[model samples]
Target: MTKAQIGLIGLGTMGSNLALNIAEKGHAVAVYNRTASKTGAFFENAADLRERIVPCATLAEFVAQIRPPRPVVLMVQAGKAVDEQIAALREHLEAGDMIIDAGNANFRDTIRRFGELEGSGLTFVGMGVSGGEEGARHGPSIMVGGAQEAWRQIEPILTDIAARFQGEPCAAWLGEGGAGHFVKTIHNGIEYADMQMIAEIYGLLRDGAGLSAGEMATIFQRWNSGPLESYLVEITAEVLRASDGATGGPLVDAILDRAGQKGTGRWAAVEAQLMGIPATTIETAVAARSLSAERDLRLKAQGAYADALPTGRLVADEAFIRDLEHALLAAKLAAYAQGFAVMEEASTEFRWDLPLGTVARIWRAGCIIRSQFLSEIAAAYDQAREPAHLLLMPAFVDTMTMASPALRRVVARGVEAGLPVPALAAALTWFDAFRQGRGTANLIQGQRDFFGAHGFERVDAQGDHHGAWSK
Candidate 1:
């Protein structure tokens, strides 16, 4: 039999779907699973595609099934499982073979893994695969980070399997080391902020504007045709429109308020804080998710403050609803700006020389946060000179100028209505701070200097200086 072109070593939903995708694309793939039984099950499910799938019972057999100078994809759980799989593969594989980690790994861990595999005669690729289960089965946005040579070897297959925006594939070698994973982390962070802002708008519409799920679903579906057009918004409409088979009510109404996260959002916030960058929107979203998990405490607190809750209902008029849409767009722009800023800082700090424009281009399709706005971001970066910050770009400047008032009004209304709008509020505050020429940090500097002799920068002078104070 002809040797498989690539090998996969997991049979979970993502792994199986990805394997099928590869096989369907005319690349013969060898597949394996830790449990062994899953390998058989996956092969059976492949059915027509089984002709191109080689299911192996053991690690050595799986490795042997692939052609020499192999590129094997590791779809196992991140962290220890990844390390274990690499170690096991190392024992069976020879020089010139490659191992690709297609999990949502911490970039630091990806960098460390690179260090571990150094001089081992094996190449390692840190790849970020986004777009959930369906994307994996069809096409996903593939972010690859490693040696250019390794990328060259796998680019054809990756590009073939990636989603396209206007016929351009959504896959690229972003940079070396953990660049792909770092970009993915920032992507998820933006996704968190985006989802939180959408949920906040939903809360305002439901409670303050007295809109039912179906009514809100109609509004969201309409918004999806405008500036806020995105996969998240599209799905929000679908989710709201869904009816619960159990109760015959809107499916969204039956769901728990608590949201779950898998750490990438927090990682994005933590990395931003470490880098001294203000990712307040992402941080606020993370905090909101944590607060959501405190269900019992929230219940008690709600009861204790029931009478104090604001009862003012918003005017559900055409003009006010348009403001809500504009507000969401403005806040969404802020979140993307912060995410891109984080990536820009990471690129410089890591010496990755990340192609920011390419990043935006790849994100225009196949990812959870895919949207029309990303195309504008790509165009903004494609200019003769890239803007220092996303919001500084002329196109974005015009957008913010036109939409910020609506954002301010929505935030003020939400606050007065006693609805939680943390993410939206954070975005507005961050945008305000970003555009301000002078901030109140001077007072903080003076207080620090007086209290701890930390000193402060003098605007009139070149160097830091101490302030005279009576202690």
Candidate 2:
């Protein structure tokens, strides 16, 4: 029997689909899972694809079945489970063999794992696989980070199975160590912000404009044809248009108001804070999710403030709807700008030489945040060696200029209606601050100097000086 070209551990949703995708792409894959029953079940239903799968009952058998300098893919749970699997794999694997972790792990853990494997002669690839279950079964966007030699061996299979934008495969080697996972984290952060912005617009249309879910679905479908065309928007339209079979009503109306998260968005927000980059849009989105989780507190607060709260719809018109669309677009741009800015700072900090254009291009398909907007982002990054900021790009500059007024109008309207639009408000504030030559931070420095001995920098003179508040 021919030796399997690759080995896969964890026969869960992502791993099983990815393994099928790899096998379908004509690479013989060795499959193993913690539970032998799952492995048995997977191969039993493999159909014609079973010819390419080498099922192993033991880790030793799994490691032995792969060819020399083997590439093993792990799709286990993140954190302790990943570490445990690595330790087990290391016991059975030889030097120069590669272990590819295709999980939503924190980048710091990826970095540490890379360091841990340094002297062992084994290669570790911290890959970020996006596009969830269906993408895994068909094609997903893959970001790889590891030794170039190992990448060369893994590239063909990954590229063949990845979703394509135009003629280019939606997969690439981002950088070394943790870079791929870091990019993935930021991608999710941007997703959170995008969803939050969409939800805010939906709220405005639903509550203020008093439009039904079907009406909002139609609006989202229309938006998908324009600048806001994206996977999330497309899914939102589908979700809005879906019917509750039991209730015979729009499915969205019957769904819970609370939102759930899986930590990547919060990780991105925390990393942005640690890097001292002002990613307010992403921050606000994280905050929005956290706020959503406080359902009981919100219910109590609503009752407590019922008499004081303003109650009534704004009776929105065509003009308001148009402005809301532009507002959502503008806010989305700001959110993407912030996410990419976080990536820029992270790249510099980690010395990862990440190609922003390639990053944008890879995100154009297969990823949750895939959008027509990312195509424009790719163009912007391609236009320069390094852009000062995404918003500074000429095309983006024009778009923001044209759309910001509508954003301001939407935000103001939401505020007056007593509706919460935190993400939108944050994006507008971030844009305003980004464009400002001077800021109020000088006053903060003054307060700091008056309390402690913290000094402030002078705009006129080239020195940091502390003022004597007594004098």
Candidate 3:
């Protein structure tokens, strides 16, 4: 029997890291990059990699190194580079060979690529690799897509290089077509909202409580012991505590408020709306980023329309804090509900059995966006139904009842101090929507404008079809 081999297409940060991991697992690796020297040096530097690294001069030779039915992973840039790599290697790869695009590709492209490659007997897979450079260099979360037959050929190697989520390896066969990239895309989307929520909470502590940077960090440190503990929130406090270079004050204030994103968040939210799932919180968070970019304009708008901020207080005690933590958990559950709702809709819409529980487990480690909350989400998927409310479930409802008041108090404090808290707002909105018997929005009108351009229900079904009053 021959040693299984993996061919890595690029040698940049992500690619290099992936190569290191693949080779580290004691498998034969055929490394290739457009720039020959860097690829040569990368493999040359590794004392153990000397035997594994078969540096090929050309794409044909690169494809030739794998014993038979080669599995080559292209971790190059998105867009044209993906097509370029495929074009260069098409003639070289044999019929049974497998091609994995580990790049952050648009999901639609993956779907199209699947069609192009399937007829030729060459398998195409779009895998989403999370856990940046370090994760790749060691172990990372790997989401795989395309045919099940293609996945079986490389599952061993993927398992070797993937991180552990819960007890299982952080790798899963996500299904055919663009399923892998779709999962990864929605993963990033949920990540966007999660980070925004933490940021909103941090901002609230700063502006609302009139607390200094160090003071806010203390609160986070305290929260870490409870349900609110998370990698991002932990980092938030560390960043807040760091000193500025010039003023020696907190470094956070010096950083720009305008955040940059890769567009997945907005894409997820938009797709959610199209699929008729609720994603208002995530959408609003994206909008909040846009609003932050226009801080000056927003300030001017505030001048045009003035209003008083709201306020609330929670009595300080261990019991209250515990209750607040429960609320935080509940809110987080709601946040995830919106995100999963999007994924669930996409999975059904696209005809893939995405293994929702497995996704939740894979997100528990190595990925940039993993949290303890994902553990709960995995169980939720095990029992969830279409359009089901996670928060309304018995377990979640009990948790919410215990903590919603305290969470609301904390949010009230933010409102009083004029701090931004979109995460909490999204959570609250989801909560109210779930708990309330009647939704006030002209749902019919919403359906018409976005779906069919129909009229809105003004008050009730009996009242009237609301059009802008001709006044």
Candidate 4:
């Protein structure tokens, strides 16, 4: 195995943490940042924080400091800045080297960059690293896209710094060309849906069960040990239970109700729609957040609807738990459905050899959207060449049957309490639509044929039962 000498750029929160992580693992890493003070500060901090690290003042110097066929990681802001930084560094780099964009880059740009860099011996990997700043400090889920040969050379150091999932690193050659960023974009989309689901559960507790944040946190903590256990759920409880310092109000109330989103979530939703994949939960979550931002509109409606609202008893814990569990499960199902849908669409579109089973296995740890159910998802993917049949598996169907009782009631309460329950609804809708509504007219096929001049099959094609619509 070849020991890799890595170079990193952008020493902000993410970059600095990554540099520190690399150094802590005992790799010879040289980092460069445009800002002189940060570069000086990082070296001094690294020596104090942990020794055995190197820093470079300029991109050229950083390139010269490391050996040839160098692996330089650009952890700058996505979009043009990534290009500018890479362009500057190119002055010192030569053919046969590698440049990695570790930002939330647009996938199309990833492909364009790959095309531009081709024929030069240099390799380009549009890499997506997830787990946020915390993930950078410990280990992050890495989605690598580019030449497979480049991946082979870089895997050693990447594996060392990546999160462990099922005894393997949370890093994979996601697919060809732009697949890394594509995967990362979808990863973020899934992240948006996951968070919205968590937020809905809190609303259910507050509105339906009349529980405080502390109480909701306890329920989340309780769910952590079961099949529903996950990193997000664990964090959900902690964040909810937290309190504001001065006002001493519930921390949930103290924080902004309006969720923040980068363009990645929108990208996933748009791509999903283009691929004709039903990203209902993901879509709904995005819409819900956008709507939430109109706080003034909500205030106006508050007075309008207060008088018309019906009086209802707040359900006790035992009863509320039944419905809450169902809502959570349903939302979880929807979230996973959107994630898999995006994955399927991207795999087909990009023609990348994405292993669905492997993908699920890699998501089992370190990633923001990891879940306890990923192991089962991996098994299902392994059982079938296609992951679309996942919901049909008898074992999984049975597991869902066991889980559904709780989710059904939870969803009901969520709906009744006026909670934003897109995740729950999305999950249930997919399951119901899949199980109960197969062979039904989708209108999608007909619409596609009409606009794109594609053909649609009649309900009874050979029986001459065609509809009377003119082309």
Q: Which stretches of candidate 4 lie over 4 Å from their true place?
A: 1-4, 48-51, 385-387, 438-456, 463-471
lDDT of 1 by residue, 290-380 (tens): 9999999999999999999999999879999999999999999999999989888989899999998999999988899999899889888
Number of the top TM-score candidate = 1
Worst 10 residues of 3 by lDDT: 309-318
lDDT of 1: 0.94
lDDT of 2 by residue, 1-471 (tens): 799999999999999999999999999999999999999999999999999999999999999999988999999999999999999998999988999999999999999999998899799999999999988988899988877777898999999999999989999999988999999999999999999999999999998888999998998898899888899999999999999999999999999999999999999999999999999999999999999999999999999998987675776688987898899999999999999999999989999988899999999888899999888888889887755799988899999999999999999989988889999999999999999998899999999989898999888899889897994
Q: RMSD of candidate 3 to the true fold?
A: 4.4
Model 1 alpha-carbon miss at residue 31, Å = 0.6
TM-score of 1: 0.99
Between candidates 3 and 4, which one is better according to TM-score? 4
lDDT of 3 by residue, 226-336 (tens): 677676667777987899989888998899777877677777777788899987777877887777889788779777766654454334355644544655666666767
Which pairs clash (backbone N, Cα, C closer than 3 Å) in model 4?
96-121, 323-409, 323-410, 324-410, 326-406, 326-407, 331-423, 331-424
Candidate 3 stretches greater than 4 Å from native: 1-4, 44-50, 243-250, 294-327, 383-387, 441-471
What is the TM-score (0 to 1) of candidate 3? 0.85
In candidate 3 the C-alpha lDDT for residue 49 amounts to 61
